[model samples]
Target chain A: MSALLQLTGVTAFYGAIQALKGVDLVVNKGEIVTLIGSNGAGKSTLMMTICGNPRARNGQIVYDGEDITRLPTFEIMRRGLAQSPEGRRIFPRMSVHENLLMGAYGRPPAEASQDMEQVFTLFPRLKERMAQRGGTLSGGEQQMLAIGRALMSRPRLLLLDEPSLGLAPLVVKLIFGAIRELNRTTGLTVLLVEQNAFQALRLAHRGYVLVNGAITMAGPGAELLARPEIRAAYLEGAH
Target chain B: MVRDAGLSALVALGLFSSMIGVRMTQGDDGMTLTGRGGALAAVVAAVFVGRLIMLAWRARRPAGTPSPKRVDAGLSRIGRYVAPVFLIAAIALPLYGGRYFLDTGILVLTYIMLGWGLSIVVGLAGLLDLGYVAFYAVGAYSYALLSTTYHLGFWTTLPIAGVLAAIWGIILGFPVLRLRGDYLAIVTLAFGEIIRVVLLNWTSLTGGPNGITDIPRPTLFGLKFNASGDADTFATYFGLDYSVTQRFVFLYYVILGLALLTNWVSLRLRRLPLGRAWEALREDEIACRALGINVTITKLTAFAIGAMFGGFAGAFFATRQAFISPESFNFAESAMVLAIVVLGGMGSQLGVALAALVMIGGSELFRDFAEYRMLIFGIGLVVMMVVRPRGLVSGRTPSIFLGKRKDIAADLVAQGRG
Candidate 1:
């Protein structure tokens, strides 16, 4: 598969305290890639840098043969890359539908209703609760809404940060299942970051192990799942 | 001694009236008579009768209980809408006064219009614009320069001045799009000062603080407010005396028209997609930017529109004053306008107008208080903010329809606390 995105020597910071340090990674076209790490392991930071939030102060981020490293968050978003940020940073005051519309905010503005319908098709539960304020949603429902909102942007690659975080086990399973189904049916590429490595790796085509702001290991999903270190750090303690 | 003197004076007036067998014939012509001491007598008599009726009515009602005003939510909303009109409609009263009081009323009206202009900036956008007077300055100066040097008519210069202010608004919007809150306010305040300094220093164009004088008054279809008044034309052309009240009525209606148009345009804009976006952007710029709502465009639109209104008011003010000066659009003027908005409620339309009246009218009315006037004004504002920090009209609700209320994210799952 062709590499759709390439990040090399990417370093990011927030005022003197470093979050990401010289990380190199690649995401292939039509792939579900998961970066499994603990909290504060630079997973979310890496995602933010890639999406041009804190901004990639150093390094090159090439997406679809264009350098988007220096672009503002909104411009980067317009270039077919979107993120469902950590904590499900959905617009709390807006309705679920409005939240989704916000995702496609810069999009042709005319295509919003059509894009929202697609989002609803992908996550029907969101359709049922479209009128509800985003904050009113349960943790699991909020995660779903956040993912659904990102999909409204019709991105080439959807960056999912902790989709399963803080969710119940069944909800985690359902979210992973949805991820798998979305990848297979829609052919939508995903760069997912998660603490639920076992489930994330199971859904992903490939996986990278992010340890202290750098990827320590990279391989196929099954290989990561089988590794002794991956087991010790993630799967061994879980059911 | 004062009480005794007042009773004796009143008794003298009564005897004087009785000696002449004074009578009032209620008609259109009697309207003129009412102005010359006749209305005062009638009003005093009416008040006495009204007080007696009120006392008798209270006596018939249940004793020992204070009567409530019976204000409901709907009634309160209606009161809010109508109260300003009822309170301020007495601008019509000044027709009975000399030209000086009518001029005073005109000044009050101009301030009300200015307050409405600033409301769009600080009220709707939530951008604390301290340089609003700068836009007013721009408009006035633009009109003065264009009208005198270019020899343009007042009507032609008015729209041109508004356009020029809006252009300045856009120019101002470009630099400070990234800044917010206190920093933005300080920058805007400096901008006002900068404009004033420029006008002062740039001696050629502005005439350097000496100001432009002898500016022509607005003419109505080639009929000047000179000896040939509206009534004179109507009398000769139609063989009927339109009365001098026609002039007063026309000027009153002209301002009324401007105020109404401003209200209409503002209200319409509020309902548009742009206004809602402005509110959303105000609430959270980060989210708005993230949503792909161009922050620069939103901020520029707000400044431009608000400045346009300021220009409108400024043009009106120039014509009203028939003189232009940098001193008129000083930092104090900006503060007073901002104070009006804050005291009114940032987002309220009517609140801004009422606040304007209170600030301007209070100052004029308290001219008797002299040095203590501003002291009283300052204390009243502080006390008002303490009583209602949001504003006088802050209690007003935003919309008719309600949105879904957020439920707290609490688990029904029991935890062992006991």
Candidate 2:
């Protein structure tokens, strides 16, 4: 499959300290590519850089035949990219339905409602808590709402940052299962960042291991999962 | 708990000693403690005793147990009827009430308009604008200058002034597009000062400190509210004897209509996508951008629309006074309007109107208090903040709801994150 997103020599910084150092990565169309890393490993930094928040100090980020290296975050989102950011930053004051509607802020109303139905189908709990305040939701439900909100944008490339963080084993399984199902059925391209290395690698088609602001390994997900060094470093005792 | 009460007593002592201990008299022996010292000590002792009682009460409650929920059914049930009843009373006031009450009503309505205008920026959009009075100034000056130079009527100048202020809002909005919270507040405050300084310096255009005078009052169609004018006066046209109260009553109704319009438009806009965008931006701006909302456009619209309303109020103020000056639009005016929004509870239209009534009417009632008016007002504000830190009406109903509409408690909503 042709590449849906390609980042070359991407360098990013926060103040004087560098967060990403010439990181190279690619996500092919109709594939789930996971980036596995520990905390403080520049995974979120790369995600934010791709969205042009603290933009890449150097390098090229091409998405769907267009250079999006310097596009503003909202502009990047308007170009069919969406991120379910870390910490599930749902608008606390907004109801669950309003938060979902916000995800379709840039789309036509009719199509947005259609996407909303798809999201509701994926997370029925969200439908049950439709009128509840976002802040009042439980941790698992809030994560589902965050994912549902991102899905409402109908993004061509969905970038998820630590989707399974702090979730129960069953909820994590459900989230990862949904991600895999989304890719399989709709050919939705996903670039997932996860601390749960074993589960992420199992779900993705290809995987990249990032350490200390640089990629240490890249290969097919099965090959990386089988590596003795990767097992010792990341997958030790992980379910 | 004993130590806490002692600390509170000490603090109260310091506060009361400086603020209420001594009085300056007109006699040769100017400074006199008199009986005020005893009163101050009594007040301090009362506060200390109150704190001790509160501490004792808290100690009696078991730890780690949730407080019992207070039933809010009666209050909300009453709230459903409050608005219609208030509207009827306001409409009937001129028929029975005398001239003084009508004047106070006009004053209260003006503040309500200003409070609503500021609410869009501070409450909905989460942009802290301490320079809102700048837009008010722009509107007043636009009306003052346009009417004086071109002899435009109040009705004609009203919209032009609003547009002019909106343009200024855009102008101010552009430079501070990236600032948020405290930084945004400081910049807006400076912008307000800049406008006032310009008005003070631009002597020829704004008439300097002397201000523009003899500006025409608003008319009812072609009829003026005066004894002698070229066209038929309001009194003559209606075939009633001329009374000064007629003008005051008319002005009161005009302001009441404007305030009601502000409330209606604000409520309508809250349900629209743009208004939802404002609340979303207020909640978390980065998430708004992630959701493909143009933050700059949202911020600009909030500022411009808010300023437009401020301009309308300013124009009305100019016509009401029949004169305009820089003194009317100042930082204190901005603070007062901002206070109304906060005290009313952010993003609640009814809260703003209630706050404006209590704050403005309370100040008006304390007019006879003279030098002590501001002191009493300060104490009232402090007590309000202590009693209800989130303002009087802390519950917020979400604009869009799927099942049944419910008011979200104030603490449930994010606080001042922007």
Candidate 3:
């Protein structure tokens, strides 16, 4: 199958400092493409760049065969690209239900309720805390809510930034299980950025290893997991 | 502790200087500096005594009072009844109130309408608009000019004035689209001053500082309130004795109806999609954009709608007085309305009205205090701020919820985050 999203030599900057330099990445349809990296390796930058926040100063971003390199962030979001941003930036004052409604802001109200039900079915914990304020949730629950809120959009492509960050082992497992289930059941295309290298590679269909601002390696998930260089650099002692 | 006392002494000195030392007079000596040494000493003594009392109080109190759980959930339970009670009392005011009370009621209602209008822009949309009086001015002038030049009645000019102010609101909203917070405030303040200056300089059109007088008063469905030989005088038509107080009562009901309409519209809009989007934008603009909300349009609609209401209040102000003047729409007027919104809990309609009654009505109550009234008002405001930093009735009920609608603690919401 053809690629769902294609990025060619995408370079992004924060003022004069370059965060993403000459990055080329692709995610095929119905596949979970994991990008594993250490701290400050441009993972979040790439995700934001795709959403046209800090717009790609050079090169192109193609999503579903359309060049969305210069579109506004809301326009990109309207085109079925949703991101559960780093640090779980949920509206703290808003309730979990309101946050979910915010996610489906671009969609029809009728379809949004159905999407909400699907999200609740995936994350039952969120359903229980539907009335709770987003800020009042635990880190793991907030992470779940962030993901669930993004899913409320029913996007064709989901960009998750550090979903496993600061989560307990069991909560991490639950989150990964949810991601896998979403991919398997709905054929959802996912571009996951993770610092938890081993679990990410094991879960992804294909994997790319990013160091500094560039991707150094790309292969099948199992092959990347087996590579000694990746094993020592990222997966070592990171069960 | 000694350093803290010294700092407090300095603050007391500064406060006394502003409050008592300097005065402006309209004489050969335009400004005068009076050395109120006794007042300064008194202020310093008061501060030191206050500090000592606070220290002693803290020392006597238990160490672990559990931080007083700033969230008074019970207060909101009581607060739910405040609006209904106040509404009932306000409706019955004309039956038993004297002329002075009725006038104060009209004044309080006008401020409440203005407060509600500003609340939409500042409180709901998170846009600090310091020059909201510009819209009020626009509305007042629109009605004033329409009535004087075109001989349009109050009813005919009301909607026209509102639309005209809304258009001006849109015009002012454009340049400030990229501005936020303090920057937005400065621009809006400048816009308000610009309107006042234009009115002052445009003598032919606006009558300059002399203002437009003898503007027609509102009639009750084409029936004049006078006993004069008009086609249908209200007193003659109804076969009642013509009393000047009847006009004041009619004006009271007119403003009460207008204020109620403002309240109803604002409360209804708060639950709509646009209002939710506004709150979202206030919370996080980037997140709002990510959610595909058009932030610019949201902000503009808030401005337009807010200005529309301000216009309605201004038109009513003109009709009530049957006169209009630039002096009536000064920066102090803007500050007064903004104070009402802030002193009322932001985003709470009931709070705004309550604040208006207290601030405006309370000022009227202290009118006998003469020059000391402002000092008392200032002290009262400081005390209120210290007691309830988030204004009275700060608890927020979420616009949308799934299960039971619990009141979100005022302390829980990050101020200026939304």
Candidate 4:
């Protein structure tokens, strides 16, 4: 399988403090790759760096076939990389439909509507709250809208940052099931960052353990889930 | 409830004590102080009564009913009818009202255009622009210079002035691209002062502090409003009396047409893709960038389009007065326009119009109050802020809605901080 996104020796910093320290990772096409890490382990930083926000201090980020390390955030996004960022930063003032339209920002209206229909099919709850402002939606519904909004872009590579951050277990299960189903049916490449290691490892085809801005272990999902170290560090005392 | 009212009255007394209670007049003795005990008592009593009424009103409401949202919706429903009635009244004003009324109408309409123009930046796009009068000055100067030097007609200079202001808007936009919130407001405020200072000092070109005079008045399709009653004059060509009121009426219609065009364009833009990008940028800049929208271009367009309208209004001001000056585009003018946008609902077009009427027309009516006009205006604004902090019409109508359309509650809509 070809690598959809390859980050080699990527480094990022917030002022003087380094967040991503020479991190190397790869996400192949048509695969669900999970990066499980504790809080402040540079998971969100890696996601933001991939989108060219803080500007990686070193290393190359190649997405699809082109190098996007030096590109602006919007330029990188225009190349079909969509991020359902941390905290589901949806447009609070806009309605759910308008928020989805914002996701399909640069696309032709006809194509956008078509993709929006596909999104609605995936998250029908969004259809019910079509006219409601995004801020008024419940947490689960907001997560669905955020993912659905990402899907509206028709992206080849979807970057999700902490989808199950503050969700109920049942809601987490529902959201994970949708992600798994999406990957299976459409061959959509996903790079999911999550603290829910057990479920992320279960849903992902492959998994990487991020420890303090560096990838310490990488292997097939079942192998990582079975490893004593990963189980102790990320999966201990949790279902 | 009485305790709360007493506490508020105490705070008001503390605030207004020095401002109202003591008066230092230029007496025979140097700055003799006098006490206005009666006025101070009246102010404190009024505050006490107003606080009591507000607390009583809140207590009267049932808990958790969301009555404010319903009231907002009702107000907006009434707002729909108000726009048409106001427009009709404006159209018919010249027929019955004398010169003073027509003049006030002209003044109010100019501000409505100015308020609407600033609304696109501060209201919709969420960019705080205290330097908006800079663009107005640009437009005014463009028309003044173009008409004086090249001998251009008002018809010719109008578009030129708008384009020039838009260009200046883009220029101002580039510097503040990374600024937000208070930083943006301060930068824009400085920009206004910079333009005024430049216009004041650039004596060779702008005529310095004395300002430009004898700027040509706008003609009606090349027909001059001359009392000579020559064949080419409006009086002779239209077979009418050459009253000065004819020119005033013509100028009135000119601003009305321009103001309507501004309103039409602003309303239409709220639906367009560029406009959507602006609202989206205002909602969340990070989300907008993630969606592949070029924020630079989005911000620049908001500025350019907003400034373009300011320019149109400025051009009108110059033509109407037949004089242009740096004094006209001061920081107070910028603050006044910003006040209209804020006092109205930021993004609501009709709210801006109503706000302009209250601010400009109400002040005109209060001209009889002489020195106390501004004091009354300040008190009214303070009361408005205390009662309705969001705005007069704060509920937002969603640009696109599905199912039964409903207005978004004011609290749900995020004001663009920058």
The per-residue C-alpha lDDT of model 1 at residue B99 equals 57
Candidate 2 positional error at B375, Å = 2.2
lDDT of 2: 0.88
lDDT of 3 at A235: 73
Name the runs in model 3 displaced over 4 angstroms. Answer: B1-40, B56-71, B403-418
lDDT-best of 1 and 2: 2
Candidate 3: give the TM-score of chain A.
0.98
Task: Evaluate model 1: give its lDDT.
Answer: 0.75
Best first by lDDT, ranked:
4, 2, 3, 1
Best by lDDT: 4
Positional deviation of A90 in candidate 4, in angstroms?
1.0
What is candidate 1's lDDT per residue for B1-418, written digit by digit as tens?
A: 3344445556655755554335445776553222335744654455455455546665675765332234234445775667666446644555476555665566666667777777777777779899999999898888777777787877788789889999999888888888899999999999999999998888887888898887766656644454453553543455555455444544555565566667777778765556655765765665555455666788899999888878877777776677988889889999988998888877777777778778887788899889999889987897776445667676433321224322211111122111
DockQ of every predicted complex: 0.10, 0.52, 0.42, 0.54
Q: Give the candidate order by descending DockQ.
A: 4, 2, 3, 1
DockQ of model 2 vs. true complex: 0.52
Worst 10 residues of 4 chain B by lDDT: B409-418
lDDT of 4 by residue, B1-418 (tens): 8899899889989988899999999998788889988898898999899989988877787755533787798998999899899999999999999999999999999999999999999999999999999999999999999999999999999999999999999999999999999999999999999999999999999999999999998998889997887887898898988899999999999999999999999989998777888888888998887778899999999999999999999999999999889999999999999999999978889889988999999999999887998898898898778667778888888787544323323322333211
Q: For model 4, what TM-score is found for chain B?
A: 0.90
Q: Of models 1 and 3, which has the larger DockQ?
A: 3
True contacts kept of 1: 0.16
Task: Output the worst ten-in-a-row residue range by lDDT, candidate 1 chain B.
Answer: B409-418
TM-score of 1: 0.73
Total backbone collisions, model 4: 1
